[model samples]
Target: MVKQERAVRTRQALVRAAAELFAAHGYARASLPAISARAGVSTGALHFHFPDKDALAGEVERVAARTVRELAGRCGRSEGSALGALVTATRQLAVTLAADPVTSAGFRLGGDPARRHRAGPLDWWQAWVRETVGRAEAAGELADGVCSEGAVVAVVAATAGFETLGSRDRDWLSRERMDRFWTLLLPCLASRPPTKEPRP
Candidate 1:
């Protein structure tokens, strides 16, 4: 147990260091040796834990996914509406992202399946979003035929798009935009009332 704990600590440090460097310089620009030095680990030890840079990226992706799972677990308890919970999660994600650029970078890098740790964190988010939407529907907060899978994909895509936009347009990433996102998302996920129209 003691040995396992020590190994876990070492891996965690490596992920933290690598994440920061990758976020700052991007995955292609980051070198393993720099990551090793930043994490205070010898190159050999770093190699032992992660055989290559891609492996390191995988670990970072896993860590980001795990963080989302933990956050979703907490958010599940809210008695708030589905739209409200979704908004809350988005805001928290932005804050959490600002604190840990490495994890955030993982998502950006994974935006290309041909590059980076492609699916780790993203898969986790997809599952969690599906589950959350499923729960909301069960509580009668969503309409019939409201596909959880579709909602999950939409939310993830929307988030990735916003992050991309935020990276480009710093001024647009705001609390107000978050609210606007909620406005757009709720109707998509909500049960639309039957509409009346004049006969053509």
Candidate 2:
């Protein structure tokens, strides 16, 4: 049991170290030696846990994907309006990306053109938005003229834009900024009733 626990901790450390590097430096620039050094693990230990940089990155992506999936699952089960849940989820995601190097690295690494086989976090977010918005439209949460596809496009684009902008300026992920975004956007998309109180 102790051996297993130690292995798990080591693996986690390596993943976190890799995430920090990947988030700060693009995948092409992040080095395995640096990752190992950051993790405070020997190169042999890192190699034992992950065969290569791509494998380490894949693990980071997996962890990030899990975080997003959990967020989506919570929103899916929310009793509030679907649109409201989406807005909240977006804010949470932005906050996570801003504060969590692992998720941020997962997004960056997943989206890197150099990545050969890993799924992209942006694609996952876009799909979730498309599906969730469609449900909102079907539930009559949207204004009469609001096109589901159009709304999806706008929301996804805005969220992606936030991710891109937040990479350089964390202000983009601030609660105030997200609340302003939802406030301006909701009236145009929502029905007569406000979805939920804006995040403070």
Worst 10 residues of 1 by lDDT: 191-200
**lDDT for each residue of candidate 2 in 1-200, tens digit (9 for 90 to 100):** 99999999999999999999988888888899999999999999999999999989989988988898888778667637788778878988988989988888887776677778568666788889998898888888999888899998998888878877998999998988998898889889988654556343
The best candidate by lDDT is 2
C-alpha RMSD of each candidate structure in angstroms = 6.9, 1.6
- lDDT digits (tens) for residues 80-178 of candidate 1: 555456656766665566566655766666764446346766667766677777777777767677777787778888877766676656534566676
TM-score on alpha carbons, each prediction = 0.75, 0.93
- Please give the CA lDDT of all the candidate structures: 0.71, 0.85
Question: For candidate 1, what is the TM-score?
Answer: 0.75
Tell me how candidate 2 scores on lDDT: 0.85
Clashing pairs in 2: none
Residue 116 miss distance in model 1 (angstroms): 6.7
